[model samples]
Target: MATILKRASKGKAGYGKIQFCGEQARRDGLQYFWVDTCCIDKSNACYVYLPDVSQSSSVLADNSNESWESFRKSEWFRRGWTLQELIAPASVDFFSREEVLLGNKTSLEQDICETTGIPATALRGSALSDFSVAERMSWTECRETTYKEDKAYSLLGIFDVYMPLIYGEGKDRALRRLREEIDKASRGTSLFKREDFSVSFSLSDVSDVEHFVARKIELVKIHKALGVDGSRRVVVLHGLGGIGKTQLTVAYAKRHKDDYSGIFWLNIKDENSLKQSFVKVAKQISREHPLALRLSNVDTNENLDDVVDAVKEWLSLLNNKRWLMIYDNYDSPKLPGKTDPTVVNIREFLPELY
Candidate 1:
């Protein structure tokens, strides 16, 4: 672990840049160099040395359209391992045989997309979960590997799954195992699946709500509050007990049901009820989100707090915006003391609005 950390600190600096090139990388504040034949940590700066693309005087020109065409056809992009190599690194610098700096991933985003068929958002570092599984799989369609099983093995990181590598396994069996692991990982996290775009509404209180009329002003206010910007927003609907606070929120959600990715409601009258609401959200989203999958299995009968935290984390993802959560019956807010154990802290259950 210490060795890995030390290498990671200096930056992983090589894409088949070994020997003298590796020495040069070490001098440039990078201690570890990678090659096509070995694997290294993904969280490091990558320096790709394309031996086929010889150094040229016009390579770095701003109008070098032909240079990008040459880059697109480079042997580097056609390898199976290159798919992971391109996407995993936070930073990548391309170079020629004579070590002339060509450009970085940011500057070459358009060319990379054209060659690989990956979306610009993905290449620009959007969460992979935000893309569909089929779309991701298509990125590797043109890549080739030495062994048949290597094609399936190369995609382990893309799907975020792992299993023992069976070298002798045929391509069909390897792909089957890969699919099984993917299925296991995505058991109930369909909320983020690009293929499953149906809006998730788990508010049971509003099931019977219909023919909502009046509160046009209140509904408009709610819409304005949530639509102000791409940031967290909250609007507390304070009113008398029987003056229809709950009904107003229900009506707002139903009226704009198609506007959100998901809609969840929590009964915030007490701590126990709030926790129960979180459990419901967890079950509704998934027993465990991909981020929380390593923590522990979330069962309603056990580890209720894990479920609560996991659900909150799921909502906090950057790509997971457009999700609306309602805290109903928040009448008994807990005071700043142990004397009121029955009361709830509304903030504890609220997710990052954006």
Candidate 2:
């Protein structure tokens, strides 16, 4: 193993495995091949997972439960380094010791999670910060490292923090240093620090969430559309009136409430109702930020349009991203020759989303 490692490092050795990897890279139309001896940005790299599971005929014949259990119990899964390699990559192709193709990460996610006790969300590439520090730490409890200090050092990618590696620091000191760096990285660094379910939220109702059946496909679409790309995402739930559009939106908000800093709902049934909702939003903001009271001067003497403009400005604050705004009952978008008093131009009420 040490000789193989040495040959892999030099990239010019007579090792058959290294030559095979190079051939695979060429077959895939690539010039570079990276091994997981060290961590890089795995999100950008395709990881070829070579687990040391035997490809014996018995293991292959029946695809039996025992065979799968043996696959899960491979030494590769027990290594501390493989944890990040499994979770960080956007793509992973698994192969057995005999170079037989097994499956990809997405295809074999359930088996991997059963072995590792990692939630499918994290394995599916949800934000690491979406998980708590304790939960992230727990993923390493079962894995082992060669050197005691390496136990802590291997976790740098998991916590998304970095520290200089000192080989002789001992495991305790290394862990203490890792924890200190994690604390420093966490302090005031979040744009939205509100606890789960503690964000300033004004939604339709909680009662609807109880009876709501999961709209799995729609939810997945919403998540994919509004990916973590730091851009404005708008998802319109259009359907016949009274066909549970409101319920769907409510369910989405409640399910993903923690994913945002704030969740605000607007009643766009009509122009008058939209203005009233904006006034309510202004009041909500004023309670948190005293400075917002100046912008939202929502007195009877003040024009409603000014209040709307002020609330929009507050929502448009540069630092306040990850806010979920739902414009409900938008059945009366203004159009040519539409003289209805209830008609509204929703564009006027929307904030400039960054």
**Which digits, one per residue and each the tens of the lDDT, describe model 2 over residues 61-122?**
78777777767888878888888888888877776666666777788888988888899998
RMSD to native, candidate 2 = 16.6
Off by over 4 Å in 1: 1-16, 37-42, 190-354
Clashing residue pairs in candidate 1 are none
lDDT of predicted model 1: 0.72
Candidate 2: C-alpha lDDT: 0.72
Score residue 212 of candidate 2 by CA lDDT. 66
| Global lDDT of each candidate | 0.72, 0.72
**Residue 295 CA displacement from its true place in model 1, Å:** 37
* Residue-by-residue lDDT tens digits, candidate 1, 265-341: 88777778888888877766652221234222456768777778878877786666777788888887766764776
The collision pairs in model 2 are none
TM-scores of all predicted structures: 0.49, 0.49
Task: State the TM-score for model 1.
Answer: 0.49
